[model samples]
Target: MDYATYIAGLPRVLAGAGVIFRDAEDRILLVEPNYRRDGKWILPGGTVESDEGETPRQAARREAAEEIGLDVALGPLLAVDWVPGTGRPPLVSYLYDGGVLDEAQLAAIRLQEAELTAWRLVAQDEAGSYLAADMQRRIRAALGALAAGRGAAELEDGYGPADLRAR
Candidate 1:
C-alpha cells in the first residue's frame, strides 16, 4: 500500500486535556467560552496540539495556565473520559487535579479574552446547571474518586466505575 493510503486508513482519535480546579470552599471553577454560540460553561481546557507531542497531563497544565493565569502544580489524574463524537473521531479527555487554589491564586485569575469571557467557582450541586450533562457526570465522578481516596478513573462516555475487570 502507498504511504498516503496507509495514513488515510489509520484510525484517528482526538485528545483534549482539562484541569479540575477547586477553591477552599470546594467549588469547581468553570469558564465560559466567548466563541460558543450555545454558551456552554466548560472546564478550563482545550485540545492537545498533537504536532507538539504534548502529553495529556502537560496539556492540562498548559491549558490551565493559559486559560486562567494560575500556575499551580497539577495533582493526580482525576478521570479519563472517552466520549463518542459527532461527525468526527471519538475523543479521549483527560482531567487532572489542579490542586486547591488559595485565595491569592483565585484573585490572580485572568481569563484569556480571545477564548474565554468569564469564570466562576460553582458549588458541586449547582455545577449541573452550568455544564452539559456529560460534563456534570464526569465532574461528579471525579469528585467521588477524590473523596474516596481512589486513583484515577477510566470512563466510557463519562459513565463511571470503568469496568476494568479482565476481559
Candidate 2:
C-alpha cells in the first residue's frame, strides 16, 4: 500500500477531495478566491484528514460545510489528480460531483479566510479562463460526460480540452 512512501512524504504530501456541484440547468458551481497568486485560481477544498471512523468523503463534506455552509449530496468520482514534483508539495486531489442542492438551501457561509473569498455558478463555457489549466480540463470533462448522459469521467487516464471544446 506504499505505506512507507506515504509516511515518508507526509509532511510534504497532502490529499484533497472536492466536488463540483451542478444544477439541472447545467450551470457549474465555482468559488473565487478573494485573492490570487502565481496566476492560479482554485476550487474550494482542503487537506483530507484521517479521523477515527471518517472516510475521505466525510472529510470532503466537512470541508464543503466549513467553506460554503451547505450539506452536499456527493455523487460519482470525477477526477484524481497527482501533484508530485511540483516543488510545493506532493498531493493527490480527488474531485467529485456532489449533486446539486437548491440555491435556497445556501445560507451565509463560514469560509476559511485562507482558502476562499467568493463563489458563484458559472456556465460551462467560462470555466477555462477562471480555473487553472487542469481544473478547467476536469470541468470540461465533467460537463461533457454529463451532457452525453454518461456518468462522471475519470481524469486519471488523461484527456484534452479539444475533447470538450465548445460546440
Per-model clash counts, in order, read 0, 0
lDDT of 2 by residue, 1-167 (tens): 59988887767656778777766666677787766675555665666885455566777778888877777767777666565545676776777777765657544545666768767677778767778777777667765665577765655323533443533
Q: List the candidate 2 regions with Cα displacement exceeding 4 Å.
A: 1-13, 51-54, 107-110, 145-152, 156-167
TM agreement with the true structure for every prediction: 0.91, 0.72
For candidate 2, the clash count comes to 0
- Highest lDDT: which candidate? 1
| Candidate 1 regions with alpha-carbon error over 4 angstroms | 2-7, 161-167
Per-residue alpha-carbon lDDT of candidate 1 for residues 31-68, written as tens digits (9 for 90 to 100): 99988787679999889988799989888888989998
Model 1 lDDT, full chain set: 0.88
Error of 2 at 49 (Å): 1.2
What root-mean-square deviation over C-alphas does model 1 reach?
2.9
- With a 3 Å backbone cut-off (N, CA, C), the pairs that clash in candidate 2 are none
Alpha-carbon local distance difference test for all models: 0.88, 0.67
